[model samples]
Target: MDHRTQLEERIAHLTRHVDELSEVVARQQSELDRLSRRVAMLMAREAERELDTGGSIPLADQKPPHW
Candidate 1:
């Protein structure tokens, strides 16, 4: 094949690969957004529970158990 035709074929292949990678990135972003919303909801619920029970942040975020 001529130089021009070979170059065009390579360009088309690279373009298709880029398009596929773009689709994968978009899907991951969508999943991350959904997880963020879920975490926000859980935090809100925990805060409301703390108000009713008068507790502090969970032991996970607290000082060492030995202290």
Candidate 2:
């Protein structure tokens, strides 16, 4: 039809798309935050387990070639 009408239609379509994307982004952000907290908790537990198991591996002492 007319230029102004075409422009209004395009604007409406873009606004609808942007609103949908905003909702999807918000949901993804929430999921990411939950996963981050879970990961942090698991890391803390792993660290505690490592400490309870004496933290690190021990290195054996070795002598030189000479008897």
State which candidate has the highest lDDT: 1
Best by TM-score: 2
TM-score of each: 0.75, 0.78
Instruction: Show model 1 residue runs off by greater than 4 Å.
Output: 56-67
Candidate 1 displacement at residue 14 in angstroms? 0.7
lDDT of 1 by residue, 1-67 (tens): 9999999999999999999999999999999999999988887787777767877774334579788
* TM match of model 2 to true structure: 0.78
Please, what are the lDDT tens digits per residue for candidate 2 over residues 5-65? 9999999999999999999999999999999999888877777777678966221223455
RMSD of each: 3.2, 9.6
Off by over 4 Å in 2: 56-67
